[model samples]
Target: MPSEIKLVNVPALGKTAGYSHLAEVRGGRTIYLSGQIAVDAQGQSVGTGDFTAQARQVFENLRLGLESVGLTFNAVVKLTVFLTDMQYLPQFRAVRDEFVNTAQPPASSLVQVAALVRPELLIEVEAIAAAP
Candidate 1:
């Protein structure tokens, strides 16, 4: 993470298993990324009916998006994750951990939605990053 970014797991807010309770960024460019799904560069769906595979692809898309803006996962301060079913939380966390900074994880929100832009899509992720 950068010196301009601060991640906090507030004791008052209770313990967080894989995300921070709050993130503070000072004097940096804030980047907002659109939600990324399991579609590849060619717009082909990468995973069908596979939650783990779809989650990995979603994170990969996020990684690419971050790279495009000259940033990395460490620059991410917040994440908004949407899933078709909450039962896939564990799988989602496992894949997300592979890409994000575990030591200083970003503040995050997880939502269960009925559907996405594509019915085959199982997960979607959006991010907010700050760079010095």
Candidate 2:
């Protein structure tokens, strides 16, 4: 393991799921990625109701974003997923499993929201990473 797991408390925010209110990983290289949507390099939506297509695009964007910082998906210690439709989660997860290491899934959170910057976009993902 590159870092120790930390439990962060935010009394004001209340409790979450199996995860802590927040997580802290000891340092190496840290990367903060902006939320990635289903948009392609040209900023066009890749998938409409097709969660798999959108998920693939999201991971591709994430991979490129990570490469820009000299890291990979394996370096990710945390991930936050925001979705306009919660019903698509199973589809997202199935596709997501193909991109990430199953043995060591990162600490993660999934949030369902009503909308995003664009109405056609259904999902957004962001990540935090630590690596040596």
Best by TM-score: 1
**lDDT (Cα, tens digit) per residue for candidate 2, span 1-132:** 454534455679885443345556765667889899989778889988787898889989999998988877777777899988889877888877877766556778899999988888888999987776
- Candidate 1 yields a Cα-based lDDT of 0.93
Instruction: Tell me the spans in candidate 1 whose CA falls farther than 4 Å from its real position.
Output: none
Note the Cα lDDT for every prediction shown. 0.93, 0.78
Clashing pairs in 2: none
- Cα lDDT tens digits, model 1, 12-88, are 88889899999999997999999999999999999799999999998888889899989999999999999999999
TM-score of each: 0.98, 0.80
In model 1, the Cα lDDT at residue 82 comes to 94
In model 1, how many backbone clashes occur? 0
